[model samples]
Target: LVKPIELWTGKQLFSVLLRPHANMRVYVNLTVREKNYSKSGETMCPNDGFVYFRNSELICGQLGKATLGNGNKDGLYSILLRDYNAYAAAACMNKLAKLSARWIGNHGFSIGIDDVQPGGRLNENKRARILEGYGKCDELIQSYNKGMLKLQPGCDAAPTLEAHISSFLNNTRETPAKVCMEELHWRNSPLTMSQCGSKGSPIN
Candidate 1:
């Protein structure tokens, strides 16, 4: 008779989905978690909050869209398909869909304005970054109008100016987004939803 193995934690259950057999191995790297873990030498969260999965088991990290989303080729679904086969990925997806439905039936979830609205230090950082980016953009615009803008490779002054401005704006946007994530509590509804890949991404 086959002995039943009990999964005592969600991480164990996830590992089972990825590596049903002892011979199977899955390596996952959640960049966001890794970045934070690397800071202040807190890599060992001791509660499975690590950015990496050692032997397909989450030892110390939270799962996020980077691992779960369909947007990337390195996502769990993609990894399953690549390391095993399409059938494996499909089977995993079916289980996930069913489990998610069951979970929803017993849970109530919502995102209120309070959950995402910037406040205090987060708002100050956002405004400061925007002002800095705007000033740089204005400088670039002034240069372009005066025909003193540096042209990008294979691009004219206007395109070069636009490219630089866009890059600055994007960095500006990302700065606040990062600050916002840091300011929000880990248990914050929107943040948790973003981290778990049950809804929108962290940037959203």
Candidate 2:
């Protein structure tokens, strides 16, 4: 049975994998494909590449390239993780998470490490670095949220809307059900019922 482990940084998701000693030889197949989608939602040009990594003090991958049909370079790529130890594997995952948050941002896709968990044990320094990296990612998310809230009209008009909504709710709380229904119908629609209603319309 294959169990997939995932880690979420504020900006991107990383999947990690770990295996036993007998399957130590690790190969990461990196496939590059065109971002252009056909009418049927299929990729136009898909090319293959490979990277080899093994257990050691310094963990790294040896890059290998693949040829495209039109002799042009591949634009988008995916990383496939395979056969890795716990320590080296977790390190690889943390590195990918950091890179995705700092460099890739929202434009790039997520990376997956084949067989590792988010809470997997690692060296002290490595763990610290990963935590620090994710903390920065959280800050980015918070900044984005604040920017989006400022762009919202409801937030901009919150002071007036809050007063209107509070008054309407408080007045309606003890009103009879039949009277409330009659008032709702007389208003024709919720949008025209109160000044706050139109501005507070749900997006979806």
Candidate 3:
């Protein structure tokens, strides 16, 4: 007679014991595939398995099959806040970052990821939102007046406008429009809307 098995370890013992053989084999194979691919696609089968794994890794990092991970996720902002080159570093982030054709003046936004897009994610919609949110332009102007060093992480830091823009963009997701508007307003002209009023539309 078979000995009674002790199921004390809190493992899913019943499921393991009664698992169907054919489905069990398929599940095992899938697990093996996951393991093999995760470890740099080493044990992947010949023909397409290695290729598929390699391409998937290249595209998604660890974000499963969707490449960009569901929707406009926060991972890109995380990467940017870490002081990475947004364009080059986008590869490591969730793959949704994309550049737009409408240029942000000479700088040309080094915006989103994905090989398909080229201009770097700037557009009229983004621009409009940015413009609308940054109602108070004098604050940044004041910071510039009081020495940008105060805004830096430490006493010795001297961040450029570009660097400050990057940090602001990353952290200001709720006000992405405002942050962007600030970037545009701050970077271009000395006179803000407050300073110039109706005539002070900086883009003009």
Candidate 4:
């Protein structure tokens, strides 16, 4: 069976490996022959490069229609992280969560180690430094734990960023669904890496 095309003019090559009277494997490879030109007879190199979904969910939706359970779980993260530079990854992590003092430094930014762990909580000094770099206030991070961060009037709920993640954690029994999956050590999950990046890359 052939895979569905997603509006690409490239030549796609597919190959399948099958054993006699046994299971089979199907693989589809897509490669662009050349740039698609415009009506002016000039080669038009698209600035967008290729047409692809932004996230893993969209890619899974497309592949699942043709073949069930074809896409990998962290494929999206792999792609995004591969393209991200060091600066981009650090910015993304900061916006996602107030780094628990443990994940500071090493991103071309100097941070005091005295305020990122259990014994080294985010004190006023470290908090100021992080806030200055990330453009976020320390009060905002504190609001996450306290019952202060509100969305609408009279509604005591976490901020949009925090709430979005908390909802996913609740669904998965407090275990992270995607990014933090490897970092967390569950019942059977062994301690593997020290700290994984937001885009599924290793941090140090």
lDDT of 4 by residue, 1-204 (tens): 145755633211101111112232211222111111112322232321222332211211111111211233233222334454444334433433443243344333332342122122323434444445344434555665675665755444655545544454344332222223332333211112111111122212
Tens digits of lDDT, candidate 1, 116-168: 78889987888888889888988999999999998889999878987998898
Those runs of model 4 whose alpha carbons end farther than 4 Å from true positions after fitting are: 1-137, 141-154, 157-204
- Across 1-204, the per-residue lDDT of candidate 3 in tens digits comes to 124864443123212322323343211111112111333544444211221222112211222222122332333233233444554334433323222122344355332333112122435545655664363234554666687534545423345544655555544444443333344433233223222232322232
Question: Of the pair 1 and 4, which is ahead by lDDT?
Answer: 1
lDDT of each prediction vs. the true structure? 0.69, 0.33, 0.33, 0.30
Model 2 misses residue 36 by how many Å? 7.0
Model 1 RMSD, rounded to 1 decimal: 7.5
| Residue 71, model 4, lDDT | 36
Give one digit per residue, the lDDT tens place, for model 2 in 47-154: 111212233211221112221123223311222223334555456556655764875565543323421112222234345545655665455446555653233345
lDDT of 2 at 134: 60
lDDT, residue 163, candidate 4: 59
Best by TM-score: 1
lDDT of 3 at 134: 62
Report model 2's TM-score to 2 decimal places: 0.18
The TM-score obtained by model 1 is 0.60
Question: Over 4 Å off in model 3, which ranges?
Answer: 1-24, 29-125, 132-138, 155-157, 160-162, 171-204
Compute the lDDT of residue 97 as modeled in candidate 3. 27
Best-fitting candidate, measured by lDDT?
1
The TM-scores of all predictions, comma-separated, are 0.60, 0.18, 0.23, 0.17
Model 3: lDDT of residue 94:
30
